[model samples]
Target: MIDSQLSRAEDPELAVQVQRLHQLKVCTRWLGVIISWLVVIPFVTWQLQEEIALMRDHFTLAAVRYALIFNPISAIAISWCLGLTTAVLLWQSGNILFGFSSRYRHQLEKQVRRIRRRGKSHVFWRWVIGSKNQ
Candidate 1:
């Protein structure tokens, strides 16, 4: 589908713009993941401080094992969820900062329609995309 779109785009500048938009999307996603992980790590550590202190004081194999297993697992799960919010914010900000071309706008509207079809049952759908009336 994208290949067809690219083939149909005769203007070199339009192609370049589309490519840059794609790159921006990819970069924002990765940046969101990094930001989420950075935020979550310190937060999770703070929340688990008591457990960490107990492990430090006792120095048991079980405590060490639990710390190794649980902290990262919980942090990752939390950060993975948070990353979506950050990514959406970042992407929206990018769109605002760099206004979309007509071609991009059409593409974005199509994507928005697809997202709207997912309905309010999706956690982020209503907040991010809004209702059909809006």
Candidate 2:
């Protein structure tokens, strides 16, 4: 299905824009996922409870203590994820700041503006489908 979308996108100009936007969106999602894991993983590890039937019972939870204590795990996890996020954000920040840097972003914004005015599905279709050749 994705191959089809990429192939379809290759055929037109709009498709290229969609593909790039898709790429950007994917990067964004990955950043979120990696960050979440960074927090959750070491968290379970620090509390020394990676697996269990139940994470919490009536009145005790290691997760709570791990989070509250002066453990480096939390700091490390947050730092790791944040460090990566920061790197990515720093890398992309220039593009976001310049907006003018990538003609693609410009084109994307143009498409958005046009779509708002014309209200046509074809606009979206083309933006996404144009990427196959790309």
Cα-based lDDT for every prediction = 0.63, 0.55
Could you tell me how far off, in angstroms, the CA of residue 64 lies in candidate 1 after the best superposition? 5.8
Predicted structure with the largest lDDT when compared to the true one: 1
Query: Cα RMSD (Å) per model?
Result: 10.1, 12.5
* Tens digit of per-residue lDDT, candidate 2, span 26-114: 57767686867766776656554532323445235665554436556655665666676777677567656764344554466465446
Colliding residue pairs in candidate 1: none
Off by over 4 Å in 1: 1-9, 54-61, 64-134
Write the residue-wise lDDT of candidate 1 on 1-134 in tens digits: 57546644743443443444455556767777777778777777786787789977897988866765777766566656576777677766776798655667567445444555776665545444535445
Please give each candidate's TM-score: 0.42, 0.34
Output the worst ten-in-a-row residue range by lDDT, candidate 2.
50-59
Question: Residue 25's C-alpha lDDT in candidate 1?
Answer: 59
